[model samples]
Target: MAKGKKKKSQPKGKTITLKMAQNSMELTVDGKRRLNLSFQEIAAVPKCLQKLCEVDELDMSRNLIRKIPDFIDQFVGIRVLDLHSNYLEELPVTIGRLQNLLVLNLCNNRLTSLPNELGLLTKLQTLHLGLNQLDTLPASIGLLKELRHIGLSDNRFTRVPGCISRLNNLQKVNLDRNPMLTEDTASQESVMISESLYVVTESFLCEHCRKKLKNKKLEISNINKVQFIAAIVANMFLGVKW
Candidate 1:
């Protein structure tokens, strides 16, 4: 008779509860420094988070959270915080207190505007705010000199803010799908898309804008050619001595 295969035994250590494991809330203390609570349909942060002082990365994305809890301030050691694809309309002012934050992802939310307090995150390098309802960014955004990449695509801005020009370290800026940029502004700003600073927009080379620019260039070229031919004829006539 064939023997049944033996079941794999659980590793010897603190056992994970079924509820905690199901929600991806297991807090392993054996040198695993990241806490992943994403896609758990969590509406509120768990109280157990207050005890996890060693967590370096906190992923709480794809949840039902509508508001950022003040307790987020307790994650003093957190370096990366991802809260993407949520129902958040506004962030807690306490978010600025995460001085160690390097990457903050709040994309695909309902935010209409950002709090000025966001400027306090001096160490932040990447910020994602795409697919939101932002009409304007706070001038204080210029304070984040360390920022490298920013996602502002699908927002409501008609013009790129002057403050964005001050971020010398800025590398990539996504401004696509915003419908308000004029042809002139788009043409002028298209030069910003280069090796160092990359800007993405739908207005730069759309069919209408391209046709307008091409026609303008062709008109100028034709005028120059006509002027040159006229000058040549005049010079020939003047050189002829009867």
Candidate 2:
């Protein structure tokens, strides 16, 4: 007769409860009815997060989380994250590990910069960077092909980076409150894709032709008023004093 097989013991731990919100789940401390977890003792993250990582959506807005939980990188299947109204100043570089993330809300944060690794989110459709203190965006951001909408309103951006036009799928781009971007400049750089991607800027609009022109592609026939006036004066004074 074989000896009785030994049984494994279940791990002992506290359970975390998440309440359902608009197409998402919200994790709260307890029955105290609070979204901000500042006063609560948060010595260690709950192991349940590992399981919840498979969850499609998560809403933890208005939290007093000063630092993102290190284990958050394990959320490989997460798609939407609402991290608005937080005190977060920087995002963990590991955020790129979320291969399935589509939408990310970073509004109303104290962020001064974004990681270049953000370019790895190739599937990202929408990204919100409004109301931050960011001074520049990594050029790598141009690599997001699936991106459709980008929000850079109310930031410190002096000029809208030219690289933004590279997003082939981009439908709308917001550059409001970037005072350095004049209406004339912004209007010129607005993307117009035809046979080839065209970057039309103020300098490309010919005054004589009243039509958009591109550098390196010259039109030989046209003459401006200044040139026409100068030529008439030279002919009158030199050829026949009139």
Candidate 3:
């Protein structure tokens, strides 16, 4: 019998390094300084983030990061921070240091609550907290007077947060799929996906997904191929370009 090829180990629980973060960063056409480290199998934020002092945007989504370090306060100059689709159970109070932040994304995590310090982002215009385990938000969220859009879909809320109605600048708010909000869910999902929610600079989730959607090889030890296939199919059916 012919010998079988050896199976390769899949990357998992990896922590991103300084070089990796540096290599993933680039300036955009609009002159926004950005660093994108999504879907890199990272399990933690790199300490090197402190060195990127001037960065305006930082994307660390779709990884396995379990805790955002206190050093995150170093990103005071940042305007956007994306931390969706990870395993975060809670956010560090230090996250409030990003006073200049305009957008913050925290979807699809395990978070049940948020730090009251989040209200410090006074200049924030958009905040997404959908697809989490949260049943409530810190009352401080009401301090976001400049907030224009907020996403609270697919959560455990029994009723809309009262603070939402107080946001004088709010132009859009999504609460579909909540235990108490589903009566209007199906009809609102399409509108939410089309005009609001899931903010992204590019059409695709990442360059790797863009080029290897159908044939991306992976070791199955730590992955659920069925779920992966379902996600791809659902995105396609929904006409999402990614």
Full candidate order by TM-score, most accurate first: 3, 1, 2
TM-score for candidate 2: 0.61
The superposed Cα distance between candidate 1 and the true structure at residue 176, in angstroms, equals: 1.1
Evaluate all candidate structures by whole-model CA lDDT and list the values in order.
0.78, 0.67, 0.82
Clashing pairs in 3: none
Worst 10 residues of 2 by lDDT: 31-40
Candidate 1 structure quality by residue, lDDT tens digits, 126-203:
999988999799888899999988988777766677777777778778776664555678474432221222463435
Q: Model 1, stretches more than 4 Å misplaced?
A: 1-32, 183-242
Question: lDDT score, residue 207, model 1?
Answer: 97
Candidate 2 lDDT over residue span 112-207, tens digit each? 989888998889999988788886999889999998888877777666677687888877666666544446674644332122222333443568
Count of backbone collisions within predicted model 2? 1
- Candidate 1 TM-score versus the reference: 0.66
Query: After superposing candidate 3, which stretches have Cα over 4 Å from the reference?
Result: 1-12, 181-242
| Residue pairs in clash, model 1 | none
